[model samples]
Target: MNNTEFQAARNRPGVERQSFKKRLSDAKFLLILFAPAMVFYILFEYLPMFGLVIAFKDYNAFKGVWASEWVGFKYFSYFFQNPDFLVLLKNTLLLGFYSILFGFPAPILLALLMNELRSIFFKRFVQTVSYLPHFISNVIMVSMIIMFLSPTSGMINQIVQWFGGDPIYFLSKPEYFRTIYVTSGIWQGVGWGTIIYLAALSSIDPHLYEAAEIDGAGRWKKMWHITLPGIVPVMFILLILNVGSLMSTSFEKVYLLYNPLVYSTADIFSTYTYRVGLLQGNFSYSTAIGMFNGITSFLLLYAANFAAKKIKQVSLW
Candidate 1:
């Protein structure tokens, strides 16, 4: 084709789409590699989302989704009006709040401490020991908690006996539920969480520390001025994510550990949904509650991202 024909082709109405198709063809190999993941998400993640419409409908399995009677937020209203709603909401919020208040900082502190260690062997050992617990399955972790907290034959009780104090029933007590859950969660996750911060710390230029030293800055001063600031962007980005997940608690841990005695403080949206939806077969009610939880999480995430972008010029977006 000559210049006139080339210009006509470029200015064609479908030129952009044709160009996009050409690009896709050129990247066909990459797309082939990515097809499995794309298919998996479409089949599992996105397709299941369509089922969420049951939240607004009565959702009779026999009636089929399309044929279900539209209740139009009836289940949502029911969930809100339920007598246990307030208690469940409070319990869920407190557990999540305690986790953020305690769990989020534990890793940051550990990462900083690990960074200060001059001995590579000792640092690796500490990291290995700390992260090993994260691999322990929730079932095993809960069992360990139960065994440790047992009033009889437990090491904790033996310690109490040695100290001439009564053996405390930790898991059975509603007041201790939040404390145990948050503490155990921190133990399991803190080391793994430090991975991101450690990566950020390594990216800091060694020159910054050397300059601080030349200025007669002490260890603490150097860390405060240089090291911390180097990772502030990463920290704020992570903080935004954590704040967004403030409504979500460890459902598996809570479900495994909680009983009727500790339900006052241990119940959460997931466990509640599991019982009411899966066990009792109240699909609509459970779907509404789950949807509510997801919406709140999204809103919280947006708020946190907005705040971080405004305050620190850092955000996930």
Candidate 2:
């Protein structure tokens, strides 16, 4: 085109293209703000995703990922046909169900209780103490539990003996494994979990509470009518997220707390995968099992999202 025509086009509204320099200038601050997070996500999350291909191959240490021979789904078939699969599935689901049934409500209850506290000093003290356990390392927490519940000489067993009861092997008993694991998780996690609900509660308007009080509503009535209703959306959103991860349990906690005696009840999918893949050095087979797990998780998430949308009109997507 001629210079005159190009000049006319630039002068027209919507005719001129956005200059790269101007666009960059406008987005500089936002780009800077997001750069670190973008880098971290790529490095820690997306980069590792490339390794998932190992699951489809008979990965050899010397041959490496690209050189490994493709084995199709032989490992996955083995996992499905294995006798231990049913036991692992049952244990994982039962533990997860128990956690949801008991552990899910504990945080909500704790948050509600904290919201009701009138004294600022007492409330601060309680929250501070509650959150401490959440920061404790898993190794330290498991060690403390073992020491506290040791049948030979632990404080719990000693107390039971004092009351004319026999010392119970809490860790070794399969029947007690789920109970101990769930309760310990509750104690360690409930307080920190309450922080999210508490933040959601803070976003609620104070006027709602004041209006409820003027209408002859007491603490219980206000909580039931106002506070509970206010947090229902937050509760529902979090519940959806939780349901999406129903298969996952903290592997460290289970592996650390369980012994051979309680493995019948405590062995879950993650621990099982760790044993077969990591300890046994069946890298290809383990990768297949891991891939199966990822696929199952994806399916579960989609199913849960669909159910949520149908039943409550809430969903992740």
Candidate 3:
């Protein structure tokens, strides 16, 4: 192109690179606002990543991480060969899968239902009650579960007796652990989870609903045609994120609720890693297992994101 055309093209509407000083000055206010979060992330999250070297070494308390003998993949092979590996893997995936299946849709469903509610006061009341469980401490929450499900004098057992049925040990049964864990997670998180969907819902143009009504579309029809499609991108993004964590069951709930009797069904990766690393101080082996979990999670996230982008043109990236 000629200089004239080039000049005209440069003048056309688009971004141009700013001088370093100018760009920094322009973003200074936002940078200042982000300082605290950057510091916190560096200190609490990124700084600790240096310890990943432990996964490769025979970590020793006296010799320290750097001084410890490099063992290559010895610790990793040890974890694979461990007797409990398959059982732990099974439990973790089962719990996480069920939670995603049952728990992920809950917030979306609740938000949609709440949006349908015309009474503002009633909606607020339900939201408040639903979110209350999220703030409760895990220890207290598990304690409450134990109390409610106690075979001897628990309220649930009392109802069972009233129905001429025998009181059963809910927590001890191997078959019941996943159900109890997943259901309790839903109860705790579903309301709080709705908050994001509600925000997404707010961004929908009111005129769409008005236009739908003008077209003689009923509530269900509007939801199906307009509302559902409107929020689908958000739902898919969250679903992909949940898929990425298929190996991570919540450690606190499982550790608190499980016992030897239910270990066959409830022993998961995080809890096993905790017992091996922190309790037993098998640092290298535990680190290897933890690293494996992290790598799998990363792969799952990438796979999910790729699939989402290909199919729906939605992704975290």
Clashes of each: 0, 0, 0
C-alpha TM-scores of all predictions:
0.91, 0.88, 0.93
**Candidate 2, poorest ten consecutive residues by summed lDDT:** 13-22
Please give the RMSD to the true structure for each candidate, in Å. 3.3, 4.7, 2.8
Clashing pairs in 2: none
lDDT of each: 0.91, 0.87, 0.91
- Ranked by TM-score, top first: 3, 1, 2
* Runs off by more than 4 Å, candidate 3: 1-18
lDDT of candidate 2 over 173-214, digit per residue (tens): 999999998998899989898998899999999999899888
What is the C-alpha lDDT profile of model 3 across 156-231, one tens digit per residue?
9999999999998999999999999999999999989998888889989999999999999999998899888889
Q: What is the lDDT of residue 157 in candidate 3?
A: 95
Clashes of 2: 0
lDDT, candidate 1, 1-317, per-residue tens: 99999999998879978998999999999999999999999999899999899999999999999899999989999999998899889988888888888998898899999999999999999999999998999999999989988999888899999999998988888999888898889999998988888999999999989988899999899889988899899888888888888878778888999999988888889999999999999998999999999899899999999998899888898
Let me know the TM-score candidate 2 reaches against the reference structure.
0.88
Candidate 3 displacement at residue 291 in angstroms: 0.3
Model 2, runs deviating above 4 Å: 1-27
